[model samples]
Target: MVNCMKEQVFFGEGMAMVKRDYPDLYEAIVALNEAAYTGKVLDYRTQKLIAMGINAAASDERATKKQMISAIKEFGVTKDEIVDVLRVVLLTSGMPPFTKGMKILGEVMEK
Candidate 1:
């Protein structure tokens, strides 16, 4: 399996800080992530897509970009698939968040 949580947490500087300064909290986060990303029913790719949609809906540009990049790299997720996810964001979150997500997705794809 991909161990999605580790892939996400270990890549970031903030997580490194947490590991050093708050080992217990970091461990708890690791445990929670293991439980959350277990792939028992939905599968990791679907979970990742859900996470991407959530970030998009929240207008979290950085998180949305990161999730898109990771989904593409790890799961071979296509641009069309991401666009489909963004369509849901458009429907539920309104234009601002959806447009922001689309812009971020474009930038990520360009790179």
Candidate 2:
């Protein structure tokens, strides 16, 4: 399984720096992350895939790519599943994000 806490943090470089630069704030964020992922109903794998979709919808190329790769490497999420997520992105987020997400998905799957 992909150890998100270790392998690749979803947080950006600025946030990484924040971990050291602002310990209190960073700790709160970390706690929030843990709480959010505790998963009352949906499994972590499903939640992670949803997160990938959210990242894609947000048009964050870096985070989307990382999430996609992690989903595949860790949980074996299929290309079809990603396509389904992209369909949602297309509807709610527009073409740019959907297009970018498709591009990123292709790149990640090719490897």
Candidate 3:
């Protein structure tokens, strides 16, 4: 049986949505990310960090911080790393989304 814990942090369902909506483009992008990261080199933690960063920039605060904390615990991402990701999102994506993401990140870190 597949481990539930192993499945929890991955994005198979999201990838399925992408595939169903835009098969060619989704496959290409997935290929690109895989090639760039190299399956072995990227590791689950790094992938989770990138996902959290993207989600934060996209204004998905709840999902972003949920993923962020999970990455922190499972992959050992540091508070500084999380903060830096938030800063990058704020700089590139503007304040509204960034603020929301930051609020969540702060709450998670304080615990």
Candidate 4:
């Protein structure tokens, strides 16, 4: 399986600064990601699906793309699943934001 943590590219330049200043919070987030994705309440794949839905609906494209790629590589989620979530986001949040999210997600998947 792909190592999601190894490919975490979000916060690129900022993570080092954060790690130096707020090590506890960074560790907490890492723990949370591992626990949330590995537990019985929701398996990794299902967690990725849910995360994709939430991210696709959110306003931050960078965060959304990062999470989406993590889900794809770690949980084996497909592009179709990401697109499906975006489609649902379009219905609820309207087309404009969803369109932007789609473009961002498309770019991430292409890479």
Candidate 5:
């Protein structure tokens, strides 16, 4: 849950609000996040890439962009590594999501 909270800050806002207004729900969400993100066979860094890819595949522009920035800042995830992830997105999710992900990645890199 602690790890999840830190990541929530990294990826976006609203966690504090949730925690204040809905402590139980916030805890549940955090618990779920912790369970999902716990490094096992896959390292946490690789999991971040997979999460970013999932967001991109869903065409979630804001989440994808935030995740790109977070991964880069946290793990030194390179643009090339992101592009590799997007390559999988292109194949699995098709062009629209792939293009959107690429655009978001480009914007993040520029900044």
Candidate 6:
């Protein structure tokens, strides 16, 4: 098997499309992204992990995997920490989403 993960994933397909077709909408989205990630109180890494967990809770496989990979590469986020986040998902999001999250976590971790 081979891992074909890319180093970066565009934050949102809709946003990217808007960026291509309508630069004005893209500007608003970019500003939002920048403001959202600014870590006024929680810090960027913590915010990223929260995003990871939220993505998992939402059963968003692609976003969860992207966050996992980005966290590991960008912030050295640990597997144990990710498992901890998934534990929250298990409680709030139920087993299926939690398991899906775990699967994505494993795949990204493996790569």
Full-model lDDT for every candidate: 0.82, 0.81, 0.69, 0.68, 0.82, 0.77
**Candidate 5 worst ten-residue window by lDDT:** 1-10
Q: Write the per-residue lDDT of candidate 6 for residues 29-80, one digit (tens) a residue.
A: 5666676667789887898888888888988787788889888988999999
Write the residue-wise lDDT of candidate 2 on 1-111 in tens digits. Answer: 112433337447477677778989777777767877876898789888888888888898888888888888888999999999999999999999999999999898888
Better of 1 and 3 by lDDT: 1
Instruction: Evaluate residue 11 in candidate 1 and report its C-alpha lDDT on the 0 to 100 scale.
Output: 35
Q: Per-residue alpha-carbon lDDT of model 4 for 1-111, expressed as tens digits?
A: 121343343334466675679999767666655665565776556766666566567666666777787777777778888888888889988887789888988798779
Where model 2 places Cα greater than 4 Å from the true spot, the runs are 1-8
lDDT tens digits, residue span 1-111, model 3: 101123433343465566679889665665565555554876766766777778888877557767877877877888788878878888899998778887887898899
Q: Tell me which residue pairs clash in candidate 2.
A: none
lDDT of 3: 0.69
Q: Can you give the TM-score per candidate against the true fold?
A: 0.89, 0.88, 0.63, 0.69, 0.86, 0.87
C-alpha RMSD by candidate, in order: 3.5, 3.7, 6.5, 4.7, 3.1, 5.6
Ranking by lDDT: 5, 1, 2, 6, 3, 4
> What TM-score would candidate 6 get against the native?
0.87
For candidate 4, report its TM-score.
Answer: 0.69
lDDT of 4 at 78: 81
- Give per-candidate clash totals: 0, 0, 0, 0, 0, 0
Output the worst ten-in-a-row residue range by lDDT, candidate 3. 1-10
Instruction: Score residue 105 of candidate 6 by CA lDDT.
Output: 82
Error of 4 at 13 (Å): 7.3
Better of 3 and 4 by TM-score: 4
